[model samples]
Target: MVNLVVTLRKKSQGIWRSSFVRSVAVVASGTAGAQAVTIAFAPLITRLYGPEAYGVQGAFISIMSVAAPIGALAYPISVVLPRRDEEALGLLRLSAYISFFIAALIAVGLWLGGEAVISLLEIESISTLIYLLPVAVLFAAWKQMAERWLIRKKAFGVIARSALANSGFLNSARALAGFVYPSGAVLIVLATVAEVLHALLMLIGIRKRTTIDLSESSEVSTSNVIELAHRHRDFPLYRAPQNTINAASKSLPVLMLATFFGPSTAGFYMLSQMVMGMPSTLVGKAVSDVFYPRITEAAHNGENLSRHILRATGSLAAIGIVPFAIVIFFGPWMFSLVFGEEWSMAGEYARWLALFFFFNFINKPSNAAVPVLGIQRGLLFYEILSTGGKVVGFLLGFYWLNSDIWAVAIFSVVGVIAYSGVMLWVYLCAVRWDRDKKAV
Candidate 1:
């Protein structure tokens, strides 16, 4: 009992004092501020655009979300892999080159069969936005590359600043356009503009804050970049597919709902995702981005990762529990009041999705551990199962069950279970790393 009490106390003390927690708080603060700005404009955006218009926007987002990961081929994740900035620079260039190549492929595909694809989603309203899909994917890739480089430097403040600017610019533009009478494609374009701005801001932030001797980077030849890409071939080979599965899984509700129900159903789904995603990204991504570097150092130096993981997991659970509890109970009421009655169904979606989001909240900080632990294949396999489970859940609800709410509930349950599995895998990886070190 005494040992248990002491351990608990130590963890409590450590949580308050850890550099990792401080960095998370800094980034979360900025992200919260950014999200607050975006949320503030939601009432206006929703009122002006309506659910059907948002449904069209949601369809555009779903397509771009899937393609974005493919465009970068998961190379941005390699920014932190190389110890030397020169090598990291090579990785960044490699990511850019791959992004352009992928974008060109998307452009060709769109030119050939864009309208037919949009017709399938029942979002023919935004068929014109299909051409912008490649542009959106390219911007997504660039934003990720810049953001990963900032993470390598532990520049949470810079990231925070850019995040705020990006949100402000994005929502402000959205509101301004909506006031002038906007179409779904216009709204999608405005969102894409925001991504482009964020990437540019990240570039400027890095330039002003972190100095890189491009002279060394310049010495790195095209061959060196190719070698760097090959060195991390697992990223494109394994991680890219994993990311695509992840993206597709997240967008499934929107895509599937639109196919069977209508644009309005997808709009409600999109709103729920928008609301939940704001808070989730604020903390989940902030925690994950900050957690990565510290864990990498611990794994490489043979330092024990158990305590760090324990503190993070406990703290994150506590952080997530209260808000999600409220969401599960009063999500519909909150959505109707905040976004108007048209979005009440969005709140219903949120109630079930809360369980899934909570699990994911706890999972995000540990996700980077997969690559560090050399268990990309394990994660990949689990991702396939998870995605498959989600699809089954959707199909069960859509066909046999014949209810959209049932489908969402089932999908959320599958996600909660799958993400729990992910958390367990990460813990085992840490334990295995420790065991190996002891044997050495």
Candidate 2:
């Protein structure tokens, strides 16, 4: 019995030490630490800023999220696929230039019609801070580019440390600012600063470790960059639209709740999302970040991917279900306990959102697999359909049921359905690809 126990222990250790598991651990640990900081500071921050301020910040973040994904036309996302460091470097530079141009375009648009757009969204509270959106977008785009390059280098440790540092700085600044001036404007400004800091940290981290001699490399010339852009046009044409629509779908509730119900309501929703999203952010994103390069490599090598996809999905489901269940059952009480009574409503929102987030959590593998499957065009249409469903569900609750909880509940249900469909479709696609590859 003693020998058997020892053997089993060794086996478990070996499994844990596997590359995939180790990579996940590195990224997840950093993310977990970051989330811990955010969680630790939440009570104090919420008390200082209150819901209305959070609502204003949430609205600004929503708009930023919708625009930031496409700021570089999704070129950074393709950075991991290139075989050569020079080519990847070229792609990186191209993405940066495009991001700058997009940022300038955003600035121009804001200069021309910023107030009207703010009025239309009913987010005039953030009117003064809205002009900073372009700068924030640029920072967000740069951060993504830097992170993607780190991912390509398999520098998961650096990526993880940067995430921890970014979260630490952002949350600390927010808490500190709240004590001095707990306005939405302050929150927005600090949030933008956090983006800039994160980008710089990631870039600096890579610069120290990377052996690529960009100064000597003439391969990243104008013509070469254009050629790389053309080669990866599918990202801009398909993935960009897909990502934008997907972001809009997720962010729509924040905007709609603010516009229809009130900013305070949106604030509640935002808090719920932030809290409920912890599991996904901690594990799902780590898994996706590590899994993407592996899946891409497997695809290039004609290896089977369905097994990987299924295994990751199953593992995430097993890990997530219990915590999500806890939220579903005791979310309101937990929120009230942690954030005080004013946040109990946010807990109510979290109860329903837990279901959506569970499916979203399990779908990370599929999300990572979609781009690898060369199905970006199809995915774009699917995103549109999914967004439409979310809109219809939200409107149905608002116009027919006339209850905020019902609206959130319906929106979450639609999200659950949409993400489930994506997982199923991606799994089937992987199976077909594997079968065809074997036949060939």
Candidate 3:
């Protein structure tokens, strides 16, 4: 009895000091667990699939990427901004309905239009993986929604478990597919199934807690749903473009590389992103999941969300910078050693892209605070400008001018600096407005 009380006290104390930290830990642990499983199976995957297989997988993921911005329909932000539990619940249900309908449409479209998409992307040469696109998109959308729900509830533990299970199973399945199928397309399909199953498990895990029993509670009214969607219209209207531009800008480089060069060259660029960007993507997401809701609440209360934002940024930078730096410095050797000589060029790409990863770690979460202040429109405009800059840079580097790898590297740096500047400027403007309003 004494020991149990002591244990509970420690847990409570930790939560009191930093609820966000606890939340991040739950998601991080799950992510780490998932990555651990993948890393353990990495050698097998590398040996079996090769860089060309990875290239095909990247194409599949890239095509399916639309599932996020479209299926979400800006509903994820609704989870953070609403003031009342009822309002939030209404938003949740409405968003889920919209998301499900969109998911179905997207799945069907991807299934039917896989050929056209492949041909458009000039990936018809490797059309064997075309059929896997829709199935993967469906599961990806499902997992994305489920993860958002968990993030909304601060159900960090559930998130961690689901992510771990999903990552482990998906990677392990990929390994098995590699051994048995050898066709990169088949391996990609199996990987998608594993991911879908993982996401479903997470949905099941959270449904018990998140579901409102109509029998025990007030009935959900049609008016409530309409009002919920209407109230949160800012999300799809303003926030969605910001997210879309950001994703588009990030995605443009690889697509350009693939178009200008080929899958083999694109694979080299992607391998770098996969390794160096992992920490930024995972850590930034975990921190954003915790900070966005809390900071939004703080903003609503006229509290200084700036300090919290800085603290979150600082924490991520501190932890992520070292790993990022190591990769930047040693990426070439690491790629060669880990993935074999064929992938040695992957290191150069990693070294080049690591700069983006570093800035992205700072840029991503800091950018989230903008939406909390309800400036998603302004954010969208800024992302559009920045994205345009990135597109120009990619074209100059990858196509219209220089196709040399070193020129691509130099242009990428210029693009990162330009985009990073825009991100920081926006963050400053948002913070200033937030502070002024809080003072008023």
Candidate 4:
């Protein structure tokens, strides 16, 4: 027994000593801190703002979520792929330009038919706040661009600090503002401000720490940006559409619940999603952010990626299963205790959502591997199928079952199956890539 204990300790120590583990720890620590702030303030925030406010905010956020990824035409995600800093800088510039254009176009549309859009979506509660959507989308796009650039430079420390700062400022502001006003518009505006602040912090960090020469004339030139855009055109053509569809699918429940049931129901669903997604934000996202560059480097060196994929998947599964199981069993009780009795329904929604999140939790490695494997086109098709499934499931529950819980339950099941299939496909693709590399 003594020998077994000693051996296990040593093995764990060895694993912790690896660079990948260290990187993940750095990012996760920051994310953990950020999530801690959000969690600490959540009970107070919920009580002050109420479900209807969150539902309004959730509806606005759903629109931003769907539009943000495509704002830069998915080019920001390609930042880590290039071998040269200059090329990466060019991609960054290209993403910024595209994001600005898209935001401007959205603003124009809103100016022309903003009221019509509100009536169409049945979201008149946010008629005044809806104009901020383009601004929020632009901020989100820029934040992602900065984050990807930091990732490419392996500036994980900066990334972590920025997350902490963003969360601290955003939550503190929300809590203070809610104490005075507690309006949905307040939440939406603060969220957008948080994005811009986070982006600026990262940009400043890059200027201070990273060795990349931003002043280099060739890197930020229009021609270089154009060249890089053409070279990575697959992002705009395939990856953009894939991301948009995936975001739409994920946000559909909130929108549908709001339109069919009421904003309060959507609010309950939103709160449940927010609470349940904490684990993914704290660990899964950290792992994905760190793992992306590592796997990209491995692919560039023609190294085998199968082992990395399997190991990451297994580790995430082990880390995520216990908390998710706890939620599955005691979700309602926990939510009632922590968030207030008003949010008990949110807990009910969380129990079913836990099943889907567990799969999503373990699928981060596979999500990171898609771009590395150059399988965006195939993934696009899969997303379409996944989205279609979600729509069918949601509509069935809404029209036939006539229960909000039923709609959420069906949506969760479809998500679980879709993410499971994605994990399998990505793992097989990694295996084939390894085999082909060996043959060469």
Quote each prediction's TM-score: 0.95, 0.98, 0.88, 0.98
lDDT of 1 at 97: 88
- TM-score of model 3 vs. true structure: 0.88
Which lDDT value does model 4 have at 280? 91
* Worst 10 contiguous positions by lDDT, candidate 2: 210-219
Q: Which ranges of candidate 4 are over 4 A from the true structure?
A: 217-220
* lDDT (C-alpha, whole model) for all candidates: 0.87, 0.92, 0.70, 0.92
Q: What is the lDDT ranking, best to worst?
A: 2, 4, 1, 3
lDDT by residue (1-440, candidate 3, tens digit) is 99999999998897667867778777777777776777678667777877766766666666666445766577756765666556666666676677678767766776777678786566774686665655665555566666666666777788778778778677866777677876657655776677679768877877665654434214557787887778778778877767766776666656666666777776777677777767755777777777777777777778766677667777777887788788778988998888778888888888777777787877656776877766677777777777777776766665555664654576468657865776666567667877688678
Model 4: per-residue Cα lDDT over 67-122, one tens digit each: 98899999999999989787888888888889999999999989999998688667
lDDT of 2 by residue, 1-440 (tens): 99999999999999898898999999999999999999999999999998888888999999999999989999999999988888898988999899999999999999999988788667776688899999999999999999898888889998899999999999999988888989988999998999899999999988887666767446578999999999999999999999999999989999999988988999999999999999999999999999999999999998889999999999999999999999999999999999989999999999999999999999999999988999999899899999999999999999999989999999999999999888899999999999999999
Candidate 4's TM-score reads 0.98
Whole-model lDDT, candidate 4?
0.92
- Tell me model 2's lDDT, rounded to 2 decimals: 0.92
Clashing pairs in 1: none
Q: Is candidate 1 or candidate 4 better by TM-score?
A: 4
Number of residue pairs clashing in candidate 1, backbone atoms closer than 3 angstroms, sequence gap of 3 or more or interchain: 0
